[model samples]
Target: MVFDASARRRLAPYRMYPYLLMTVEVPSRGITDQWRRTGLARLLAEEIALAT
Candidate 1:
């Protein structure tokens, strides 16, 4: 779900308790640098799924 620009509380803290095993793909350094420029250092669950 794409959100509007004025959505309230767009950013929040993420905590993983007793973490489960999963295949995690780490983005490349170049991608991370680009995100930092755009203030997108992290992503929501839905956004991550969409990205994959």
Candidate 2:
């Protein structure tokens, strides 16, 4: 899913706090495959600046 400008704006304020909730949906058959192939966790960490 592509995060557009409006989505970024909406999420910007959460940057100042810790722990932002997010939901992701993936097809059952592709869940493991996608998790192993993607850098989603890393990407989210970078986006939210979660040091730990």
Candidate 3:
């Protein structure tokens, strides 16, 4: 979370067996309108690339 709670999921990269990156968008006039209520959902994905 580099920026804030707004940056929690938005600015974070998952730390796991196969690390991943993600991006999220917020709606203009819905719950996301309020930074405190942007209850985004979790997803499952496969890793395609990695660097060492």
Candidate 4:
């Protein structure tokens, strides 16, 4: 999925200063493991909350 400039702008508030680009490609198992190992999902949740 991709976000357009406007969408990215909308998320600006939740984003930390000095935006960084990170790309991750992992197997389903790895994704699940990381989901549990780190609170990555919360980051998305927080962004969405701020967008609202």
Candidate 5:
């Protein structure tokens, strides 16, 4: 999704939550580099879907 300034402001607080939560807390932290991005994207999609 294309985000504007408003979206950035809305998400600024929890920006690290998703990345660190899924990576640091979960053992799946094994995912690194390119694949790491894919994992984070899936996490974001799940969040958006749940929010909707």
Candidate 6:
């Protein structure tokens, strides 16, 4: 899946870290919003809460 500019900006901070294990969450109804990931592939999931 691909994210547009707005989504990329919103998620930019999370993508900066590729080593440590972290979680991020963005509010959206899209099915791709949930996953277990690491590195630059990590994105908004069902756990970590972030204020957009």
- Specify the highest-TM-score model's number: 5
- Clashing residue pairs found in predicted model 4: none
Q: What are the per-residue Cα lDDT tens digits for candidate 5 across 1-52?
A: 9877677657754764766566664446565576566777677666555434
lDDT of 4: 0.50
Worst 10 residues of 4 by lDDT: 16-25
Q: Write the per-residue lDDT of candidate 3 for residues 1-52, one digit (tens) a residue.
A: 2345544444334432222122232334343334223211222222112211
Candidate 2: C-alpha lDDT: 0.50
Most accurate candidate by lDDT: 5
Q: Which sequence of candidate numbers ranks them by lDDT, best first? A: 5, 4, 2, 6, 1, 3
Cα RMSD for predicted model 1: 11.2
lDDT of 4 at 29: 34
When sorted by TM-score, best at the front, the candidate numbers are 5, 4, 2, 6, 3, 1
TM-scores for candidates 1 onward, in order: 0.18, 0.33, 0.19, 0.36, 0.39, 0.31
Structure candidate 1, residue pairs in collision: none
> Which candidate would rank higher by lDDT, 2 or 6?
2
Clash count, candidate 6: 0
lDDT on C-alpha atoms for all candidate structures: 0.32, 0.50, 0.30, 0.50, 0.63, 0.43
The segments of candidate 5 whose C-alpha lies over 4 angstroms from its true place after superposition are: 1-17, 20-32
| C-alpha lDDT of candidate 5 relative to the true structure | 0.63
Better of 5 and 6 by lDDT: 5
Q: Write the per-residue lDDT of candidate 1 for residues 1-52, one digit (tens) a residue.
A: 8645433234222221111111122243234445343333233444444333
Q: Give one digit per residue, the lDDT tens place, for model 6 in 1-52.
A: 9877678667756654442233333223233433434322434331123323
Q: Per-residue lDDT tens digits of candidate 2, residues 1-52?
A: 8777777767756652332322244344346655433555555567665332
Better of 1 and 2 by TM-score: 2
| TM-score, cand. 3 vs. native | 0.19
